[model samples]
Target: MSRTILEVTDLRKDYRQRRGLVSMLTGQGRVIPAVDGVSFYLRENETVGLVGESGCGKTTIGRTVLRLTDASSGRIVFDGRDITTLSRAELRPLRREMQMIFQDLDAGLNPEMRVRDILREALTVHERPSDAEIAGRVRELLEQVSLKDSKLANFPSELSGGEKRRVGIARVLAVRPRLIVADEPTSALDISIQAQVVNLLRDLQKNLGLTYLFISHDLPVVELVSQKVAVMYLGRIVEMGLAERIAHQPRHPYTGILWSSLADKQTTEVTRRVTNVAVERERRTWGVFDFEQPTSGCRFAPRCPLYKEKGRPAICTDPASEPQLRDVGHGHVVACHFA
Candidate 1:
């Protein structure tokens, strides 16, 4: 059986801006919490999809997990090691096991570097391969991503968007990473091309036993590839469970609305008290979303149809509390007071 490859806990990142010299002196910079106390895991040959609205901090979670950027707080355990506090030197060697397939940032590659140079740069960082060896491996990696070595001589400007992404994939494969964090790999491409890229990733995963943290706002794509799905909103995961469970029978009001709209049931002509009760009850068995998204009660009451007014932010603004990710019957989980 595939074993767990990654574990995350209480991850939090906050960005603060200095208002002024006086504000800096007074320690009054405004704080924006991008990701707050989030936890999840991914296993070998397992794909976990994170879906949320833009600016909901889904991207922040992926980057922090890879240490592509520093995190403000949290523990990230990867490949049986806690990477949260690893030094840059320690992380450098671990690069062989961790890689990222970026969606947009790699698009503007230098027109000068051949495919060999780009792939070789990664090889040079961790291992010492002779020039001839690098050339041979470059050809091999490109072929794995379904590209030609001749295309290696070309620039990013010369390849189609899908092809460029394939090159990006090839670059990661060169390092032989065990866990690949694919962040929005298909968002900017046409639907037809998105399938190609995703399929390629899936095939690569099956062949290599790779673990994936697939982050995107695309719901259907998440459903297709992810064994489990985590739904984020305003910097917290509001709901989580099997992709099918979370997609078809969401318990969190926001998730319900999201899934409903996607399922073409958003009209609410007969607003459900909840319209998705059957879905919630099913999730009750699995008890997903057991913890409060916010330390407070409801993070989604403002948009929830089943919300009951209460006292304090801890009380009033707080979301539902019960329905831990207990096993309902199927492998499903949901979080919502009612669920």
Candidate 2:
């Protein structure tokens, strides 16, 4: 196996909500586990795709990895260093080794600054490079991301969506990060532009030898970019393994359901063959998830179709102990009783 660039172990990030007057008096409050015990590893030059529903904590995991948001518990080891509890001052010098590509290209860029200035700022912030070096680096970054020199003077708004996204990639490259936690990098663009950005990202990864934690709900995009795929639900990863296995022979019901929903003919047929279960009719909400942290057992049991089809079995709902990810074979692991 190649060197592990990023390893997240039992990572959890929770948000405590304030209570109203009546609720406060009654001692009622809620704790939402935005990222609950998500564990994964990204090897050097690898892209691990995190795919899930909108509120399934994909973005939270990305942010928590970079310490953009403080984690509630667990460890974040990057480049063999345990940085989970590193203070801001301690982490400052390490920042250059990691970066994030936001979903909103323009929002991440400074509207007031020109494209060249933005890239220059990234290079200047971490080290005292001379003006000549900064300028040369800026031009190199633009070329690396396939941007033209004319774009140097353009503000974020003046650029096309694809160009803005390229600029975002350039900014991250300016610091020469080893691992990038790209949270929906292509989410906001049209289909054509999405492919362009995806190709650009892939090319950069190949040439720069970058590792990526590519988080997105777009299954097709993830299929193209990732070597491994992790399917999360209610803040926990229910299924994860090699991308081809997850795509063609997903063991977890949630993973199967997601692939079945894809419109592509090839994808639909492959999912149908691997999972045997036909997509459920009357597509209502699968199950309800309460606001507070779940006590135990499989968090996805309530919404799982397999649970329902199996007559809501007690083993699934009240598992003897919380289901842990177990290897089925070929490095595929699933966290469900039936999987």
Candidate 3:
């Protein structure tokens, strides 16, 4: 078995929201739990996909795990070392081994610098390589990410969207990172370009033995790239399992609804897989709930079709009886009262 590379335990990241002037004056704000008790692990050279709707904390979890953002509570273990409380100086050395590919195409690229200069900066961050060594590594990075050497002279503003993305990836690779948190890497690309980038990522992972915490809303792509998929809802993972099982045999109602909705969108018709008239009705009527005013018991109970199908069971709404993730079988875990 491959060794576990990253382990996050009950990770929580909260952001304080101050709405009006009165709240800001009083130095008081409502705490919003962006990542509420998220826990998962990634094995060496394996990919674990984190999938959810927008604002469901997928990006927050990715950032928190990399220590790009501090966690409110919980532990983040990277390469078996507890880095949750590591100071900036201590974390600096570890940064080379872990990196994030932001969702933005131009995230790491400096507009003022050419692609070659940008890559040189990343290569020299942790260590001072000689000029010759830097030149050689720069060539290798461009080849690794399938970028033409001629494009190295162009600034980020001169490059196309796909070229900018490739340059961003090359910059990350210059550090020789083992674990990469890819935040919606393909979301911003054109449909034709998306496939090319996806293939490039897969090839790089296979050749370099890279581990990834792939965060995206594209279910099909997640299923393609990830060994395991954890489905998040309202800042918490409600279902987690092998990619195939989570896609086909989802236990949580939210998971079912998610896949079903995707199917509806693709086929442009009502999906009979996991949704019907009642579920559609519930989805249409479901009210938006946030972390500030979380509902009692299961946060998903308000929009769950199963809750209504069971005639509104009190346990599903009881504050003391909130559902917890329990092992079903074959490493599948779900948080539902009647899963």
Best by lDDT: 3
**Which 10 successive residues of model 3 have the least lDDT summed?**
267-276
Point to the candidate with the largest TM-score: 3
Q: Give stretches of model 3 more than 4 Å off.
A: 19-28, 267-277, 288-292
Which 10-residue span in candidate 2 carries the lowest summed lDDT?
274-283
> Which parts of model 1 have CA positions greater than 4 angstroms off?
18-27, 105-108, 265-296, 308-331
Which has the better lDDT: candidate 1, or candidate 2?
2
lDDT of 3 by residue, 1-339 (tens): 999999999999998876788577867777888889989999999999999999899999999999999999999999999999999999999999999999999898889999989999999998899999999999999999889999999999999999999999999998899999999999999989989999999999999999999999999899999999999998899999999999889999998878876876775442555545666677667776554556899988888889989999999989998889999999999999999
lDDT of 1 by residue, 160-272 (tens): 88888888888788889999888899987887998998899999989888889999877778889999999887788878888878876666667876665455433453244
Give the Cα error of residue 132 in candidate 1, in Å.
Answer: 3.1
> Please, what is the whole-model Cα lDDT of each candidate in the order they appear?
0.76, 0.86, 0.91
> Which pairs clash (backbone N, Cα, C closer than 3 Å) in model 3?
none
* Candidate 1 vs candidate 3, lDDT winner: 3
TM-score-best of 2 and 3: 3
lDDT of 2 at 10: 97
What is the TM-score of candidate 3?
0.94
